[model samples]
Target: MKLRLGAGGTLRYGAGGTTDLDLPGDLTGQVVTVDLRHVDPGSDAGATALLSELIARGAARLVISGTDTASARALLASAQHDAPPSGLAA
Candidate 1:
């Protein structure tokens, strides 16, 4: 995966591995968009880890978008059912 710094200071994640997607920098007020088209989160742990990691960084919003709406829904469902990130209220 790759993280691109957008013109508006938005951070975008392209398809890739954990190393590629690792927090590129402190999020602060940045908005993060994870391009999930080819993202294969095989298990709940993987999904949770992905979401929690992004959330923990303190982005204004972490947007997971892809061509596959079904996969997106599943990912969202998994996140909702699992434990929330540390800074977020459950």
Candidate 2:
């Protein structure tokens, strides 16, 4: 199964290219947890985008769980480094 975070804070999860569910909510100032254990390797772009969007939307923190935790952290760090400055106070 693959989990995708949509533009409008909707979570899409499914298998075989079919989205089976969408859980919608605001992510502002929230700590979001993402599990990427089942995600394919070498798909860092999507994960990076997700991290960027989360930070841009004011997520307080992120908890990433997967087989490649180190890589995930590195991705998040890169995303944070490349993220645009936000109006929200740190």
Candidate 3:
């Protein structure tokens, strides 16, 4: 997990190539920017759970890169309403 600090103390987290992800409990309930580029999220228990945890963290914006996989695209779709304004694309 990589964090990008932004204006107003915003915490942005980038999770790249997450074949094995272990999200810390402390990160829960904290709004964060999640970048899942090049990560195959399908059926990965850790990845799926992490995504849900991020969403529950309060409107975390999800960003993806490269050829969008179905699971990755689903992640993008889940946050599409926030995409236009947040500039988060797949």
Candidate 4:
């Protein structure tokens, strides 16, 4: 499946653990928000893992512009925990 992470971030995920994040894609400056707070328990782990990887690779950043505070908090929390490397800079 393909998912667009607002503001130029994009990701592709498929079976067998194959995935890609960022990859020079464009978000078209559309400020869409994702409700991460209520992500089902089953998918939370995967979301966290994917966000961690995106941060690690400098492919994503935290931005707030939605009505869902809980979701923003969850995403921010994940970013903080992972803490992408400064030098990696994508």
Candidate 5:
């Protein structure tokens, strides 16, 4: 996984491709930018799992990246109101 320090304390994770990240509580409130459209299906589950784990361990927010920044922002805005993409009660 790649990591970069971003402006305003954001932690940019990926830009050109997709990757599974293991974020910790220490990074809470930090932005997690990634190219979701290119995320491999196999890695998607793992990435979601990692995010879920982070939430359980006390993470608060994530910032996803896409071809369009506006779309990414809209997606994240909606994401904020929804549950993490995995491990919800059925």
Candidate 6:
């Protein structure tokens, strides 16, 4: 089975074709972990939106785990570019 972040940041899970899975509404002060095992590398649009929402909603921490750590980290990093300004720039 493969898990991927589909369009609009919807989580898709299953083998062959994927199906949308409902994500939690609020992530405030929560530690959310996203599994990216067996997922293909592609556009990070959905991931970016998800990361934005997680940050906007005050998620305590995000743990990305999977066989494809590099791709997962890259995906998260891409989302950082679209994140809201936090005045952390140099």
Which has the greatest lDDT? 2
User: What lDDT tens digits, residue by residue, belong to model 4 across residues 1-90?
Assistant: 233332223334333323564433333222323333334444444555555554554544434433266755786687658755545534
TM-scores for all candidates: the values are 0.50, 0.67, 0.36, 0.41, 0.37, 0.55
Which regions in candidate 1 have their CA more than 4 angstroms from the true location? 1-21, 41-45, 67-74, 80-90
How many collisions between residues are there in candidate 4?
0
Give, for candidate 6, the lowest lDDT window spanning 10 residues. Answer: 1-10
Best by TM-score: 2
lDDT of 5: 0.43
Report lDDT (Cα) of residue 80, candidate 1.
53
The per-residue C-alpha lDDT of model 4 at residue 12 equals 41
lDDT value, candidate 2, whole model: 0.65
Model 5 agreement with the true structure over 64-90: per-residue lDDT tens digits? 543366754554444434435333322
**Candidate 1 global lDDT:** 0.52
- Candidate 4 global TM-score: 0.41
Model 5 reaches what TM-score against the true structure?
Answer: 0.37
Lowest summed lDDT over 10 consecutive residues: which window, candidate 4? Answer: 1-10
- Estimate candidate 4's alpha-carbon lDDT, on a 0 to 1 scale: 0.45
User: All candidates' lDDT scores?
Assistant: 0.52, 0.65, 0.43, 0.45, 0.43, 0.59
Report backbone clashes per prediction. 2, 0, 0, 0, 0, 0
lDDT of 1 by residue, 18-84 (tens): 3323464456566666554443445334544555555565555656665367765676566655635
Candidate 6 differs from the real structure by a C-alpha RMSD in angstroms, to one decimal, of 5.8
Global Cα RMSD, each model:
7.7, 5.7, 10.9, 8.4, 9.1, 5.8
- Stretches of model 4 off by over 4 angstroms after superposition: 1-42, 60-67, 83-86
